[model samples]
Target: MTASQDVLGEVLADLRAESAELDGLVAGLPPTGWAAPTPATGWTVAHQIAHLAWTDQRALLAANDPEEFRREATKYLAGPDAASFIDDGAEEGARLPQGELLAHWRTGRAALEEALAALARGVRLPWYGTSMSAASMATARIMETWAHGTDVADTLGVVREPTDRLRHVVRIGVRARDFAYAAHGLEPPAEPFRVEVTGPGGQVWAHGPEDAGCKVTGSALDFCLLVTQRLHRDDARVRAEGAEAERWLGIAQAFAGPPGGGRERRGAPAPEGDG
Candidate 1:
């Protein structure tokens, strides 16, 4: 379905802001910093940024040339390395010189933005596991960017200042509640649960029915971290009022694809990457 111009503009703007913030963080890193391992098992900081760039290029292709994307995707899925495709892409980009890789990411990001903004009416871009409108695609980009950026930040021992942009991530997390259950081979709840979380700006963002029996309430930041699988359930301070809601929190996921084996408890060493 087509998205309203006003809302699409807002999401695209947020996408740019989210990308730029991470770009700024990595742009200042020295060459050695690129080799420094992030929490993701085998990914260094370079791998993290490279993954974003690689995915951005794929998105650009999906938006600009669907026929080619489908052909390429078919070949990819049928290939021997299909299971490792994501990691393989990151590895290929990670091998480039830091300067070259950075430039590649910058160019790709710009082109993707142009493609998404210019998408024709009634066009829904095909993506792995689903299709999405320009706005949905852009919002997903922001979500992934934030999730991976968290890994980079953790690697550098930097604590990013939370922002209201997390609202996009939060929205996805809540929407994906059933996807989480299905991903885990469990039956989805029959009814939706009420979700309310306080954003970084101290604004309460609420979703689902107000009178729903199952309800979740807590800090938006914690919920985002939980859904992204960046923070373990035990480490998050979010609360749930019903059994279904509580169970959902344990498997909450905003990103598409297989269930992410979430990071270990707060004190445990984090898995190599958030993805």
Candidate 2:
């Protein structure tokens, strides 16, 4: 579907809101806090923010100059160990001082916001995997911001509040069901499963055929955590009624990449959000 200005505007507004929340979370962090280890194994809080900043920079480039960005991506992919580029880039970025990294993140975020705003309606931009309309891209950015923001919150031992903002994230997660299976070199189930999430605002968000035998239902926050790989499926309240739906819960991922080894049930502290 073509992106309309109003839809894009709403997505952008959500993106900004997610960024503002994360910005507040880290604005007062001391050096030690920035270096504190998070649940993502080797990544510290600083690495989380740095990774977001680096991605924002790349997204800005993709929006403004697709051809140039593709050329660079091709070259980067041709490197002997190119699969490590994301991890390597995050490590390299994490070397900056906390203050500098925060500043860079803010600047990169603004640049990307501006670049997206300038795109014409219905415009699609190239990403690491497939292309996305401006609206879709904005939603993806919001999803990432929230996902990483949770890691930051976890590291600080702070609880975040659930908001209606998660609607965007949940939508992307449901939409990405097929992609998640494909990433694992497995064929997606032919039957579509119904998804019914009760959002924080008391709104019920439903997708797919309502009569589908397989179904997933639960709190929107839990579903978002599941799709983002932030919480183990066993730790979430989300229920999958059928085999296909259960499989989806086990392997769901919102962001594009190789199928991720999801967060383990290591007695990791549950994210302090809605149940």
Q: After superposition, how far is residue 212 of candidate 2 from its true place, in Å?
A: 1.8
Stretches off by above 4 angstroms in model 2 are 1-3, 266-275
Instruction: List per-prediction Cα lDDT, in the order shown.
Output: 0.89, 0.87
Q: Which tens-of-lDDT digit does each residue in 1-275 have in candidate 2?
A: 34487788888988999999999999998999999988777888888998899888888988999898898788877887566777777888899998899999999998898889889876788887678988888999999999999989988989999999899999999989999898788899988889999998889999989999999999999999999998888889899999889988998999976665568675754342211
Candidate 1 ranges with C-alpha deviation above 4 Å: 1-3, 272-274
- For candidate 2, give the lDDT of residue 32: 93
lDDT of 1 by residue, 32-87 (tens): 99999987888899999999999999999999899898888888778997767888
Q: What is the C-alpha RMSD of each candidate to the true structure, in Å?
A: 2.0, 3.5
